[model samples]
Target: MSDSSDGIAGIPHPNPLRRLTLDQLRRRTSVKWREYPEDVLPLWVAEMDVTLAEPVVRAVTDALALGDTGYPHGTGYAEALSGFAHRRWGWDGLAVARTKAVPDVMTGIVELMRLLTGPGDAVVVNSPVYPPFYPFLGDLDRRVVEAPLGPEGRLDLDAIEDAFHRETAGGRRTALLLCNPQNPTGTVHTAEELTAVAALADRYGARVVADEIHAPLTAPDATFVPYLSVPGGENGFSLMSASKGWNLAGLKAALAIAGPAAAADLARLPGEVVDGPSHLCVIAHTTALREGVDWLDALLAGLDENRRLLTKLLAERLPAVRYRPSQATYLAWLDCRDLGLGDDPAAAFLERGRVALNGGLPFGTGGAGHVRLNLATSPEILTEAVDRMATG
Candidate 1:
């Protein structure tokens, strides 16, 4: 909470995650705070426990002050995302001409899948992924195919290729709903791995639609490879947003970026779909990407510290529970099979520990015996959560 500047454009860059007290967080009405009872420490959802960056707040407030609530126009979101990608991931392949504004990452994925494949077609996903992939694709009447991650929680090329081969049989169209810097596990896919995936998709005539909303939250030690930047990935699509990185989820805006070869298909996105993002949200997301780097850096530092802290806390207090420090995002996937808890450890944690975490069951195959913990909170809360889990 110190006002001391950390030297980025003379803006103070203290750890945003640690700035707010538990009482302040409890006052929040967001789902992360309100999903459970008042006594429960909620850390299940993707929402971050941080204040908005100054530039983002200023942009949204100025727009509201001017009554600038209206339909979005122009390529500001794409342009801002392009600059952020280049600066953060060294990715310059985000072609502004091939980008479309979408409501959010999951919704964008749904629309993109609709464009790429039809009902009864297969949508291959790496299992133990974002739970929404199952239901969202199901809503489209697309068959959900699982290619579970490897033992280490990284993609399994063999499993992916096998699924690709099986799903593409009988001339059925397929699409791969990839999660770059995967949710829950936080394994940042490498360029080599993505290239291989692209090759498999190419071989099987399957399109790749990546949910890259978590792209910006990759740890300092890891590199996030935009799927479109890989060889044979020209037909891939990526959905990115500053919402996750800047804690702007309630604002709701994201970009659907298409590879060079997929531009034509993306152009076919319905006019109604293109009109989905909130104008105010576009301004907020754009400002965050364009001017909030210092704040994002401070947040990343704080999350990295929390990741390490969780490791120590689990090792000391709940050694039986296994947690692999994630390479991206604030979510931590913990293996609780060793703790003698049932398949849904999150259930026991919630009831006995008075803490909330995302259960692994709904994530599909390879999800049982695991739970996803949100590490975007303060160290004190994280430590206390672990202590409660230990006694529970």
Candidate 2:
């Protein structure tokens, strides 16, 4: 692969995913590497197979050297995110004052849901989504109502409206947990679609909490429309992080952004909740958003190539499997029903092919016979995975 210049001190930016070898990855103690045996090629989780960005590494090390391991303070993380949004997405509406620091996206979502709804209230989600949405809300005592995505893996606004009307009929409150640039399927929601969602939320008196963790991973050809940037979205909330884009999940830090109209609700967030993020992680995430742009661009380019490569490999080898190139994120949703595998094709892949993938059943409706493949790895590994699946 050719190097992309950052134009800063004439430095070249190479693909981060290609920086580490299989032997190096095997040494990793993270869940992605340790989940399966040495023979099984693991590609199930959202974790990326890449090295950390130089700036993020530098920032964290500098902080550690200075013993800056205390609690987080200041608006640096939020400010950096605002600048990133403006530069990358042309979104100038991420006000620093309306933002709060949280441990991660899911925790932020739970806290926001607490502010919006009480127990037994309904939480609407597009089905065949991130698996955690089901158990998380259920554990909170909030009913998980499904508005399955349309056949083409796009949002079904009609299903959403129906869910909203049905859930709110008994004077119960409802909240929509939107997955922007959806997980597994990787469909980036369009601006028109988000605007319609805001309108429907207004019609049904439902609050919208968007999980926009995958926003920065959108392919160059696609546009990621932030839910709070749309019409009638002033009451919505969003959670964003550099974890997915920069591969800093273990660091654990995210920002909770509230629309202008929802500022008061955000203010209700407890002080202890704001104290959850690791101070060192805030430094790392902030540095990633502010100075890791070039590295992120290179990673995106690598992911784009991997997605296309997967398409060609599947066509040539696993022709029975159907895969649509994702518009965003380094995840490819594969329809493996025709492969003669059961609802959980991942099980067959692991046992027979020695390649671990996430099964579709746990992702809720429309997920049977489907598998989610991680496309954020070296091209060689990805090609080998496809070859193994084909012969298995």
Task: Flag clash pairs in model 2.
Answer: none
Off by over 4 Å in 1: 1-12
Instruction: Output the lDDT of residue 250, model 1.
Output: 95
For 1-392, candidate 2 gives per-residue lDDT tens digits of 22212325556578988988899999999999998899999888999999888888888999999999998889999999998998888999999999999999999999899889999999999978999988888888999999999999999999999999998897789999999989989999999999999999999899999999999999989999899999999999999999899999999999999999999999999988889999999999998888888899889999999988999999999999999999999999999999889899999999888999999999999999999999899998999899889888
* Cα shift from native, residue 238, model 1 (Å): 0.6
Q: Write the per-residue lDDT of candidate 1 for residues 223-312, one digit (tens) a residue.
A: 889999999999899999998999998999998999999999999989888899989999989888888888888999999999999999
Candidate 1 at residue 362, lDDT? 92
Model 2: residues with Cα > 4 Å off, grouped in runs: 1-11
Per-model root-mean-square deviation over C-alphas: 2.5, 2.4
The alpha-carbon lDDT assigned to residue 44 of candidate 1 equals: 95
